[model samples]
Target: MIDDIMSSIFESGIRGRYSFETFVLNLLKEHIAKQDKPFSTNEKNQKLGDGYAEFGFDRFTGPTIVDIKGKASKLTLISAAFGLSARLERACADIENLSNYIIVFGSRVSLEQRKLFDIQLAAKKVSVNKNVNVILWGLDDLDKLATKHKKKTKEIVDNIFSLRLEDAINKSTTDWISERDDLLLKLKSLYKDGQFSLFLGAGVSSSANMPNWEDLLNSLYVKYINNEFSDEGLIDESKISILADWLSSVNDTSTLMVARYLRKALLNGSSEDALFTDQITESLYSNIGDKANDGSPLLTSIVAMCLPKRRGAKVKSIVTYNFDDLLERQLEKSKIDYKCIFSEGVINSPDELPVYHVHGFLPKEKDSFDSIDRSTLVFSEEGYHYIYTNAYHWTNLVQLNSLRDSSCLMIGLSMTDPNLRRLLDISARSTETIKHYAFLRRLTANRILDKNHEEGRVVIEEEVISGLLKRHHTLSEELMKDLGVKVVWYEDHKDLPGILDSIVD
Candidate 1:
């Protein structure tokens, strides 16, 4: 019997023109109306009720009124509900017998949106009649009603569910398009003015086959275990840094030794890694090495994009947490003169682009090509602590001056990096108006979509994507308040080059 009814619904075809509210009203009349005292819709009540109009209430049983709405945008639905509340308040003032009021939506409501609806409804009731009972019915409640009452109504329920999902996706896509346009405008203005300093993080060097912070630390720990320690029991999977520190103590060597091993490993494994090395001469008379001229395409493109906008003016300073010389090499190849400042008491030339290596840079000399100076590089927990404490140090002073004077554009950074957190902590105490911008990738639900979610999935549902976006937006707001950095989100890294082109071209 149920199969026959579903077959008929399929044959009839659910057209967009069909009124979902009228269909639901008929279903209520069949299942809810008493046989002797028969409930009816507003259309039927027109002839029997007192010479009053029946426009707002779709269905009613005596003094109880029910309002039904089809799938709609949140703003449209909320506005309609507010209008209904005002009408109800005016009606209750005239009609003392009206008591029960139920509002039903043929779509889903988010938990936060539901709470807002309840608060508004309660306020409306307090203004009307304290004794009046108001009930809100979402898609879940309608599904339960279909299951409990009649099997034939299931076809209508399924159609409404599909329509609601479509409505949600359309709304989210429209909102995202509007936001992307606004962000593009802001980026263009900032780039044209050259008021921002670039803050490069580890992600910028990953394209050159450089190991990330974790991988670099883990590589050092493995080398330490092999060369210095025989027992692997000292390895703490949660804290790779602690193990590296312990290995340095046991070997009676500085943590800089571990850093050099990781750098050598990175250089030996990939030819691309050589592009990030510092300039070195074999002898006083010998020519500079090929590494000095070679530039990473990633860094070169970034420099090319920003350099043209300066129009003979000095480009904004570029500060990096990376120890590599990629930015310096790229700037030199572009014929844009830049001052490479690493130590304290060095006066910067206002005519040249200032490239500050805040963490430290690899030292290079004609005779020291095969050897790296450990004292120049900052690595390990102790090195970081020393740099942070010594305010007069060249690197520390340069960073403090940049944060105080320039608006920063942070790139290739992860939100969870400890260095970024520490920078924010320092910026928080500043009395100057410090504005910063960061480029972040948008969160997607693809990671959470597994085989279990593939049954009816054509695409990820809007609700899942919306939740991820909301979570990131909340975090962005917190970062804005605490760090004074406004995040501009991109859908993918591939989109970054085009965005940069738009800003400077």
Candidate 2:
């Protein structure tokens, strides 16, 4: 039980320490001598401590300050110490008050370092006019608290998995929204003026049952590897799981490298020559299966933007990184005049909403639409190389023109692709007018910590997760600004449609 509790505590990110602290806070709430109730998180933050227990029910004698040190840097300790001291001093609370100061270190501390820190802590407590009882507890000491309160410990462990921090997280996430409303309003006002264009990415189609980039590449690798053209292949589809397992766990190669190899094998196969776009289309639709036509709210919002409500409103132009023709199909079903642009020389009429398929288009091949040129599909690693290396490539020119000329609102793009970022950077650096905008999701502890826990991976540093929770939004904002794209942050993917609706409403 001690091992289990401590394992979670050290699992990295804000999960372990925060969970334990909250658990301890709950225990204090049920304390026999607490001040009617537990200290609120807001109070804790104000005090620079996880919590300070105000024991002694009859008289309310004092505050037993509890500090949970997940990572005990000298600076952090000193800051906590001096900060607490200053806070107590400001309150004019009597020095040598009845309450004790408790410091819980989540990891091993060297005896020399522990003694030195303890002395400093003692001095701080004395300065605060506290009882001077400085209890510095290490990992083993933390176990005693859990071991002593077995039922409470179990409750805390269960609470961690159940996402007990949600209320606090929701509160923190909500605070960021109002400040971002101005940007959303600015964007909507521009859209009202017919000044904004849409730059859509894979994220828009994610909910429509399309595989992500990694999954798509992996699926293609599996399909091509088992093809009749391969010299050594998994012939029996019954053994597909084994093949997949090998690819997932045993294969150490990168996704792009594996994709490149698999694509080349299919291309050079002895049987029917497999076109890259056709292969992609097959893999894509296979994943989409029944959800091929079931568009996501994000997609619906984009489709709505393409055909505006107002009589004289200009139809919004779109530049998409996706290869799927869901957008084309959506527009077609609405009977909206829209042109699919994949070819270099293809010119869109002024009356038609232009949907540029910048990557390549191989929509469910059975669907009747524009005749796709095999050369136009940038569907393979080699294809990517061709466009990336060639400065004057048609795809480059198309994207560059859009980036340079339009105030494109980017959706579902991570901006990780160097080629895309390069184009964005170039356009941004060159222009002074019409800055771009993106809807960025703020990174929360729930994602990194909970995901790692769910995946059975060792949780990384708690401080890292906590620091990112506190700082990543600002950091991401600065990063996007560097690319000349202003960010409008949302809390979750589910919030995306609403964000889109807010801007387009």
Candidate 3:
């Protein structure tokens, strides 16, 4: 019977499965109503109602509970335990007592399991008093229940098409805006101190059309395998991914690999005696204080660094995991006087320099043949060790520490990447004066399916938006308390490019 229901689900698609669940719930509600029993709504209410599936009774018998199990093959035993725990917690908190339930959904509940559940109930392991009743239900039980309550079941089936699943998903569950606002204010305050440094991870580059280190290496492999590299066999995808993963947002390995890879892939060879060495030598002299092009702003988010210049306010530094020169480009475009440093040999320390490229740039060799052998550019484990182990390497841990002691503005970073997460933790611990602000992007679930309507004014139901705020918004608060890091969640990245500049300008 379970197999038959699952088969029907597979054949009917997602909508069909949802319809079946809805029909079952409605049938249960109708039956309870017919019995004319008192149904206890139990929600004197605060926040989201009881976590279990809603159940109704004929009269005010108190919270008619329904233990709902939404099943897909992906639902694991661990998830089941978590779900049950959540419902139990909600029940004890809101209703002040457990209630009767009608368990439904999932093929896992066989007859044997049902008998065990019954036994558990008898033993008080599963009970309304404990808020654990309405044990698992099998497909066979649902089929039987459908047969027993045929009239009520048919009404639900007939009205299934009109049911709004979207409404359920969009239901509001939490109030988390205060948390979000607190984070943003802290971020705003942190950036004002101007002593911190930034460590951008792949999350930052997500908007810039650049791939993460792992993806970049994967692309390199693809290019190499197809004759892009001289020793294509030497390039291992797994090894590259490992190296990329191991390097933190602010690590010696990061610069080494980037510089090495860029030299090899972009400059055609190693940087030793490379043609770009001369260009580096010249850009040092002639363009020492040249402004960047308006089109390609580097040192972006510089506005985020600006604060009312006091006599002793410290200058901020930037450490990017990115391969592009956009940050420097922005600084230059803004005509901000600052030293420019990269992982490569070029290090400008004219005192007022604000940005540091932890990862070096591609060689500037004018002549293709004279360029550093591209392979010599950093991208591998050996390269990461070489430049970092050396004390004189550009933007080493020391420099990063120096910058980190000040307040930092982190933009375009995902909180999940291990590298950036480590940097945030480390920097927060080491820097006494360092507070950090991160500009995070928020994604809204679109209700309208039309591609054209995706960009238009689509309402994100209040409930749905609130629920998201509850879960993801906590990141902002936790970071503040734990590391003194402040993160502002923004609906659009394009709107606040000058979070950095707003302070400095």
Best by lDDT: 2
Any runs in candidate 1 off by more than 4 Å, and if so which?
A: 1-174, 229-297, 306-310, 363-376, 425-434, 450-469
lDDT by residue (74-185, candidate 2, tens digit) is 7655655656566555434542354666666656556766666756768766365534455666656656556767787677667753433442442244356776887788
Off by over 4 Å in 3: 1-192, 200-222, 225-292, 295-314, 343-350, 363-378, 381-396, 416-420, 427-434, 447-469, 472-484, 498-505
lDDT of candidate 1 vs native?
0.55
lDDT of each: 0.55, 0.66, 0.47
Candidate 2: list runs displaced more than 4 Å.
Answer: 1-174, 228-235, 248-254, 269-274, 432-434, 455-464
State the TM-score for model 3: 0.42
For model 1, residues 233-333, the per-residue Cα lDDT tens digits are: 55455555567666555645444555555455534555543332331111111222455445455565578754744365424788888766666667767
What is the clash count for each candidate, in the order shown? 1, 6, 53
Predictions ranked by lDDT, top down? 2, 1, 3
After aligning candidate 3 to the native by TM-score, how far in Å is the CA of 67 from where it should be? 40
Model 3 lDDT per residue over 1-505, tens place:
3355445442232334344555555555555556764332223431223223233344324454554454423233234443444555665666544565455554555565555455544554432345434445557667766677766655555566443242233332343356455655665555555455666545544444445555554444343333443365665655654544443333335544554553455345554544534433333223222332332221345433532256433455656655445455455556666654553454445456545555444422324222223323333445555555654554456344643566555666666543345445555544322255666765544422243366675665667665665554553444442354555666666655544444444
Cα RMSD to native, each candidate? 18.2, 16.0, 16.5
